[model samples]
Target: MDKVYDHRKYEQKIYSLWEKNGAFTPKVDKSKNPFTIIMPPPNANDPLHVGHAREVATQDILIRYHRMKGNSTLWLPGSDHAGIETQYVFEKKLREKGKSRSDYDRDTLYNMIWDYVKDNTGVMEKQLRQLGASCDWSRFKFTLDEKIIKIVYKTFKKLYYDGLIYRGERIVNYCPLCGTSFSQLEVNYIEKEDELYYLDYETLTIATTRPETIFADVAIAVNPKDNKYKKLVGKAAKIPLINREVPIITDRLVDLNFGTGALKVTPGHDPVDFEIGEKHIPSIISVIDMEGKMINTPEKYISMKASVAREEVVKDLEEKGYIKKRERLHHSVGVCYKHKTPIEPIVSKQWFIKVKPLAEISKAALKKGEVKIVAKKYDKIAHHWLNNLKDWNISRQIVWGIRIPAWRCDKCLEWTITDGVVPKNCVSCGHEKLIQDPDTFDTWFSSGQWPYATLLAQSRISNFQFPISKNDKAKFEDFDYFYPTSVMNPAYDILPFWVIRMIMLGLYATTRVPFKIVLLHGLVRDRFGVKISKSKGNVINPIEMINKYGADSLRMASIWGSLVENDSSLSEDNIRGQRNFANKIWNAARFIFLESVAKRGGYSKAPTTKNSYDLKIIKQLRVTTKKVTRLLEKYRLNEAAETLYDFFWNQFANDYLEKTKSRRKDAQKILDFVLQESLKLLHPFMPFVTEAIWQESKNRFNNTTLISSSWPK
Candidate 1:
């Protein structure tokens, strides 16, 4: 053994050995039960943040643990094209080069982003390897893989034929920065401070945060139950800036306490107002264009952005004495999750999925406990999301994802949908020249099908389709072993967006649960409890930490104190302490090997029961072994990690090895036996250093490699 521990030398060499020996690959053994996990695919084009590192650690712990338990374990690795998010990143790069997507045709831009995603995928896979992830690289998939796309297309075709998909001109959450539309799940609410403008109308005062939308207002809405505005409901109110007279309508959806008793109704601007106006107003007007600039208004503010036009319209209203008063207020504003820009609700033609049926089916399965969430608290959250499910907007107006396999007829304006090919002509008419919808499925649409797609792709079954009508699960070779994967481990924040959709889509496609368990890990936040992001300049780079403190320390520190489905704070002190533990492990191994192999001329055989010190530590080892195994089975990695750390440091190193140093031969045997078994127990959480120590002290291990060794008995 070396005199001092230095991890920079051993981590890369140990990982290379594992990879070269195909240690990560699983066999198709029917004798052994399969334990599989599909890695939650990360965005390919964006640099992987610390959050990715945390997930890799959590997933790897389970994969390695199951492998030592003699199961056919497979951790399928992948990357997502991340439709809108990837295009947003690529477009920012294009903008820096003074080019945009409009500068090229659809094929040209798609191919360009393909290259970008490919290059970044390579970089990301390398990072995952450096972080000691044990996912099978041979099974690595890209969400845009040809076979995966076929599955996505097939699912869409079946949904369309089943009357679950629709095309309509409804209000969509639009992101001007990304030049795309987002699903409601992709938008988050933030409390924003803004001014509330009270406008003076003839009969009543209307309060609005967006006076620029006055040009689009078709009515003023009041709570039908409010007596103060009962008479005003039948009258007409003039819009302040546009001076257009819109009718006053009463509806119960209006909040009477928000601003005034009445609110401005811009059907094309707000989703709630759109619903209300659809009932009372005769027409809908759109003044803000998709680019978030004023349009269909007076020439003075026609080209101004929404923010600039708001100031101009407010100034005009104040000068005309139509403003009653102003006050500051905080309200929830819908913003894009990726671009961080305020979402503009605009009426646009897009594709949607009726999720109610799927949600109900999935909820029934959850009620039966067919699929269990690790933390019981998340069960209510999952059930609530399922109960209140809305139609999923599955289409994105971007070029970086699987384009919808549907076409629109130029003559009849009807859609012709297919599985994986362009229709010869419009299904409704004999038009030979049909144009495909220039849109892509939302990234989640493809990702929701990941587990089955990746598993089925390994087989030659060409007849696989959705709405499975048979009981045979052996049609696909890999699916037979890996279907109903052991667990779906992902961050809790994506529970609704990804996990729920996976359950719904998986059941619809394969007629089986995607995974038996859903284990959600917490977010890795900064010390101040803020999310770690590059925009905040507080990003903790995992590779840098690996280079400094080593991979085992980083992995141990990430999973040590994290609770399931909660956010955890990242601390440099925690990582430093874990590094000290790694050194302690290394030094203890050195002392045992020196005494047993070199000084005592290779001591062997178990210590006799006359030595109670040895017996006491052995009994404690059995208890620790039982406790750690139980904890790992329960998806409690944090508690398991703490158990190993306490047993190895406090019980074995500090107490047992110290108190029995005077009994030469008996102490050496007990020391060698306990140290070897402890390394096996700790190998899952801190693989690199423990494996390195196992290799250097080869006489201690019965197996050639620590990773392939059995759990401590």
Candidate 2:
């Protein structure tokens, strides 16, 4: 064995060997129970950061451990076709080339993005290998793959025909910059300090944060219980800048304590106002276009950006005595998750899934413990979100995803949603002239079916062809065996964005939970506990970390440094400490090989007389093995890692190895057994170093490889 364990020298070589030998492919042994995990597919739009590294490491630990335990294990890998994010990245590249998506037609732009993502997917898969993700490469999937897209289309068609999906004009979180609509879960809310404008309407003062949306206001709202506005409930008020007559109505939704005790109702621009307008008001006005530019307003304000229009409107209102007062206030505002631009609530015709019924089933399942959430605290959060669920907006104005199957008749304007292919005529009116819906399904809409779709794709029953018969039960041997996956490990920040949707859709499609266990991990932050982001210039590249400190060392540091449920901050010093731990293991193994075995040529038999120290060490090893197994079973990975580190470094290397130096033969026998067993226990956490040492000492073991070796008993 070499004096030092260098991970860079062995990681790629060992990973390639494992891949070549099909070590990651699951063996369908009917005797042993099956264990499966569907990887939370990463976005193929960019290189992975440290968070992805940690996630892959944790998942690989579980996978390798289960495989060694003689279970038919599978870790399926894939990547997401992140609609808005991919478009954003490609658009940036286009700007560098002095062009944009508009430079080509829809089909051309879609194909361009597909090619861009294909290249990026290769880069991401290579990175996953570098991080030692032992996912079955043969079963790798892409969200936009023909087979997966077919499954997505089938799910959409099923939901539409079942009356769970509808198309209507409703307020949606619209990212003007991306020219798309997002579900509420996709918007990130940030608090900002801005001026609250108090505008003078005909007889009442209305307060609003977005003065630019005044033209869309259909009414002025006051609390029915507030005495200050009791007499003005049934009156009409003229809008400030637009001079539009809007009714003054009493609504319990109004917060009387909030500025001026009156609210401007802009149904086309605010979610709460839309609900109120839908109930009481007849007309809905939309003053802003999909591009975030002013529209359906005066020519002076037309075509101006919302922020620019805000300034112009505010200035004009003050000069015309329509601005009664202005106060500084801090309020939370929704923004696009990708571009960070303020999200505009726009009323548009979009497809929506009625989520209330689905949420009820998921909530009941949680209470029944059909799906167990780790760290129990998140159960309340999941429950609350489901209890107050709103209809999910699952349509986006993008071209690089599964186009909605619905089509409209060009002559009669009636719509028809077919199973897969475009119909010859509309279902409502037999008009041959038809146009397909120009929008695609939201990214999450397709990803929500990831667990089922990926498994269905693996089945022989699915031929990657759309319009699958509704009566045909989508089932195969693999789907039946791994339908309810054993575990689902995902970042906690995406609890609502991805997790809940997966559970709901999984149950809806398969009549079973997506996974039995939901292990939620936290964000990967910097040393200061601040989240790592490219904009902050604090993002840690996992590849750079691997290059500097070996992949095994980096994995050890990530596991030992923090618990699964808590945010962990990475530092060079922490990783360096783990590297030193790796060195200790290497040196100890080298000492056992050089001083004991090599000096005396190999031993033919086990030590006949067991000394007191030998018995003591064996007892400690048994206890440690049992403890580590229990910890791993309970998903207490950090505790398991720390326990192994202490037992190996402090107990075995420090105390036992020192005592056995004088007794070479006995030392060889005992150290060989202890080291081999220790390697098995630690292999899951630090696979490369352990595997390299195991390979060097392969003659002492019966197993062909450490990864396929039996778990420590």
Best by lDDT: 1
Question: What are the per-residue Cα lDDT tens digits for candidate 2 across 408-440?
Answer: 988889778865677998788798988899899
Highest TM-score: give the candidate number: 2
> Backbone clashes per model, in order?
0, 0
Pairing residues by index, what is the TM-score of model 1? Answer: 0.95
Off by over 4 Å in 2: 463-475, 595-609
lDDT of 1 by residue, 1-713 (tens): 88887988898899998988788999999999999999999877666667887788889989999999999999999888888777878888999999988999999999999998888777888889888999999988889888889889999999999999999778899988778888888898999999999888767888889888888988888888889887676779887656678889889899978888788888898899989987888478898887999899999999899999999999998999999999998989999887778999998888999999999999999989999998988888999999987789999988989999998888898889998788889888879878899899998999999988899887766576676545546677688788889899888889999999999999988889999999988889888889887778887888888888988888888876767567878877778899999999999888877764543322233445668888999899889999999999988888999999999999999988889778857677778778877888899999999899888975456666788888765
Instruction: Estimate every model's Cα lDDT from 0 to 1.
Output: 0.86, 0.86
Instruction: Report the Cα lDDT for residue 186, model 1.
Output: 84
lDDT (C-alpha) at residue 340 in model 1: 76
The alpha-carbon lDDT assigned to residue 80 of candidate 1 equals 89
After TM-score superposition, the amount by which residue 431's alpha carbon in candidate 2 deviates from its true location, in angstroms, is 2.7
The total number of steric clashes, by the backbone 3 Å criterion, in model 2 comes to 0
